[model samples]
Target: MHDAVIGGGRSPLQPRALVARSWSRVLEAGLDPDGRHPRDPLPMDQVLARRRESPVALVIEELRAIISSVADASQFLMVVTDADGIILWREGAARVRGRADSLGFEEGAEWTEEVVGTNAIGTALAEASPVQLFSAEHFEAEQHPWYCTAAPIHDPRTGELLGIVDVSGPAMTLHPAIVALVETAVRLAESQLWRHHELRLERLRAVAAPVLASVTGPLLLVDDHGWVAHTAGIAAQARIAVPRDRRPLTVPGLGLCLPEPLGDGWLVRPAGGETRIVMTLDLTGPPAVAVSGERPWRAPLTARHAEILLLLHRAGRSGLSAAALSSRLYGDAEHVVAVRAEVSRLRRTLGGVVESQPYRISPAVEMAVLGAPAG
Candidate 1:
């Protein structure tokens, strides 16, 4: 079917829409169907570095137990990759692992579609959705003998993609239940990660309790990632931009402020002498955002987040709900999860300037737009 539809351009047994979409993308990338299966994997040192840095690293042993336990070890191999599709951890059937080694499916191999054509790991990353490919469904002829199921693992709190968990083996070993197994593993991993995050926050809260009671005036206690652990004297937002030394942070209602290092988090308070600040969202060129205060700063915005700001600005004081933002941004409201995630990341990046629970620009920020695209 892959050859008939992808090469001959037509087939009575039409490919599944997802598979067809992947074939089209692989073709566009100009990969040869007969290309060699093996490519040079990253050095061991680099692989270790990525493993240490990935959030998925926290749940490696749990994933091993969940996925490998459900399968006949010799019939399946489990692999984990970071958000960029670089394999970080791989284990399971030693026999199947040998097959994977021959195909360069070992750790540190970058399995993104652009590099290896349409396979489970790369396709899941491209579609931002779980994927399964069997036999001839693979874009690469060399991969035609393999079957794989993959699902994206996400950070539960912010909806950020953390990595992918995939199971693969010879086509003869493909199990219909493998996809479900991967999905379950993904859920477990994310929940474990979230639990870890919550525990850290709780510990920080404990450490912060006494310090906050003694402080006067408004302040916020946030972790390194700006997650609010505690607040006092101020009407607090859940998060703010990541705190860094020597850089000024602008908080809604709190005015411009400097973040001081607390035990394991930050203590944020007004940098004194405050006045109303005018912030600008410039849609001109590459999405530029600037804060106009005594200690002014600018943050770079991705085009998507830029559109988000433009929409919020247009929505005025009424603000737009996640469903509304989903419809406006994606032409449908089914993407509420994705919409919320984008908005969460935006709120964290821009801090208090963008308020939530019906997203809108903070009243404290007098926002003006320049060269915004007209609908």
Candidate 2:
């Protein structure tokens, strides 16, 4: 069925829609269906660096405890990769591990659809969802002997993709429950990640409690993402614009403030009662908003938010309505809801610096655009 559908581009027994889509993407990316591609896994030192940097590393023991024992007993390999689909860890029976190595399924190997054709790891990453592929369902002929099930793990705080966890083994031994097992493990991992986040916040609250008691005015102790860990005098807000070291943030109740790092988090104090903020919007390079002064730090902006800010700044006091903003951004007003949603996120990043009667910069903010508004 795989050859008939992918080779001849037609088959009476159609591949699953997801599989077919992955095959199309692999072909479009110029990956060969029949030819073998040899890859050199990244050097052990570099692989170690990535492992140290990946959040997945913290939960690896948990994953190994849950899946590695099963893989070893079942003649399978438990694999983990960063969101880029680069394999970071692989463990199982030595014999099964050897077989995987023959297929270049080793630590540090890039296994995305473009790199190695459609399979569980690559397809899961490409689709940003779970995937299971067996035998001939794989795009690369070399992978026809194996079955793989994989699911993505995401950061509980940001929903940013952390990595993928996969189980792969001989095709004939593929159990119907393998995919479910992988999905369950991913859920457990994400929950554990959230638990870790809460624990960190708890530590921050404990450390800052004494310091906060001494401070008199309305202020907040927030993490790097602007999550309020502890509030001194102000009503607590769930979040403000993300805090960058030394960057001035126009916090809603706190006014413009500079966030200074303290231990694991930052201490956000009103900037000596200075209510006005000066920001530079630089589109000359990768679009970043920079705040300069005693404590100066820069935060990179997403393209969407950058464009929205530019449009808002250009509009001046009038601001752009959701419908008008939608039309300007998407070439149609059909995206009004999307435009509004994005503006909400943008506001979270800039706090009171962004206002939404229509969506314009706050009058208290002095923003200067750098380079062409081409972003």
Candidate 3:
């Protein structure tokens, strides 16, 4: 047992450094190497209830056909687990399913590292990345005959870990390419989740359009979690993280403000004003714009918004018309409405610093590039 636990030489099939560290943790938990690790299965009714409530339920259902095809060809057991590492769903060839069942790999079984040693499902969840474990690499002696590859799936909206998708089979069936296959499947699942959010955003946009037409000042429509679903006077960046609480929140470029409950999320309005607002644009990374002086605030800009702002800043006294800006932004003069919408959102964040008609920055506001000297 000691020799198996602390081998001197590294085998070609040995676990990666991260997996090895996980194995150490499993041992520290005092799980017996030879003894049968107790199975902690949730009640069948409870498991069914939990699966129904899971956000990934539809995603997993849609991927079933693809997962079935892979399982049939590779003789691998396909398993999906919740974030807690409890098996929520399982599908595979009859023989593989039978073999896995004998080892307590059925639905409702807990496979967290502390509960079941360092297997692919648990380790992938722990590391929040794709992983593969072959034969002896599995910390448990009983699991030594199996090879497994798994990838962590994340909630597209919140970027939170949702669950894991794993493919496991006999060690002799190990194929190095299985890791990539599992990762690809995970990506498809995440994309499906993203589409779900997009659909919800579209519905929210419809509801907001009418409300926005009434408001004269800048306003935005966000989801229940503070993610921007659509905007009227605010730049519709990919997302805006607003505080979940009702406390006064500080917005970048727009000083301290209180969020008023509107539709699914809150409508933010600036509480104070700034005399001299200096805006900094950093084009290298995510392209963020920071407003500095007295009460400082900053916000990230989408690629399109960043380009429009840069063009306007360079225009100086000669502002660009909607048609000219449309051609520059979308390569078509017909997209004037789209150009106007973007400018309106930009104005909301920049306050009176950004002007329309001929889109241009306000004379009082100073614009600076991070790597370049302040102008």
Candidate 4:
């Protein structure tokens, strides 16, 4: 593979190792190189809906200015896709857009290797790396006229593969630096995404501070999928398995307990022991929770408020920054105003329990989960 030649000559007739591999995979999948069109293009409405809900939507929005700045005078088109290669957004020169539309390269088109043969979008995702394909490097005869560079974008928090961002234009427009340009854009998008997550975490930390201020024992805060967001008193060696479904299970160290629904996740505490304090998170209707200890109290929480609390609890004493909380809450860290306003309301509701300045819960409190054994 190292010895394989990359694009250089006037015509990109030579297949790089990665492109050659993609060609092989395409052939094995039984796609015809002469196929006139790709398969399973989503409807425009569906594509718009997906874009609205996609995690990368905000990133793409933020990149609009950068995209225009970098590609305004060029024929290159900017494309964003979901991990599966469904194009969610495409923007560029009108002439180039028309050409791309003729080739079924519009939004909602699926460009997976199995569907579209060897192309930059599918190949980059398949190889999990940045890729540039030019002219004859593409397996499909029709795609040979196009040159494209693409790079996969990943979740900043979980490192999960989110999708790919690509730049495409006529083969004659190919530049050696296009690959680097696409890579830079992907990095900027990822950085923006990270900032958003940090903001959301910060908001959560603010809400959890009050709840945490009331706890005084080993505790763990986990999201709906059981990913630990925060912890206290529990040793690092303790591995707790949180069930995906709402079922009771015996966790190591914690004993038999069912996860109680809190915010967007579950608050797991021991079922039986010298239980001195109790917190009941009622998610049945309008979100509400009750904390009982020396200071018995209950508060009605809005859905957003509940989510903030859960994230804060998960963050534990390390706390969360505004950027982190904003990302987690709204998928965009730039929504700092929303986070601040929400935190303000939360403080008013919970009183002096929640604190600011790198938001975190008070150490004087300990949160423990308690649930009845699943039937």
TM-score (all chains, Cα) for each model: 0.76, 0.84, 0.64, 0.64
- Alpha-carbon deviation at 316 in model 4, angstroms: 35
Among these predicted structures, which one has the highest lDDT? 2
Q: Show the colliding residue pairs in model 1.
A: none
Residue lDDT tens for model 2, 1-375: 888877765677988999989999988888788998767799999999999999998899889888987877799999999988899999998988999888999999999888899989999998999898889889999999999999999998878899999999999898888988898889889999888878888999898777777778878888866777888777877776777655566776777777877767889888995667878899999988886666565778899998988998889999989899999999999998798779878766665578777678877789899985443
lDDT per residue, candidate 1, 263-289, as tens digits?
888989887765445788887778988
How many residue pairs clash (N, CA or C atoms closer than 3 angstroms) in each of the candidate models, in the order given?
0, 0, 6, 29
lDDT of each: 0.85, 0.85, 0.76, 0.72
Q: Rank the candidate models, highest lDDT first.
A: 2, 1, 3, 4
Model 4's TM-score against the true structure: 0.64
- The digit string of per-residue lDDT tens for model 4 on 1-375 reads 212322222443545678768877877898776677546688889998998878998788766766746665788899989988999989988889999988899889999888888888999889999888878788778888899989899987767789989899989988887877887888899999988766654555565667767877666666543555567776543234444333333444555444566565456666444233345555566777676643466778898887776777678888888788999898989998789778867755653234466665444334442331222
Off-target runs (Cα >4 Å) in candidate 4 are 1-14, 236-246, 249-253, 273-375
What lDDT does model 3 reach? 0.76
- Candidate 3, residue 273: Cα displacement in angstroms equals 14
Q: Candidate 2: misplaced stretches above 4 Å?
A: 280-309, 318-359, 369-375
Where is the poorest 10-residue window by lDDT in model 4?
Answer: 1-10
Candidates ranked by TM-score: 2, 1, 4, 3
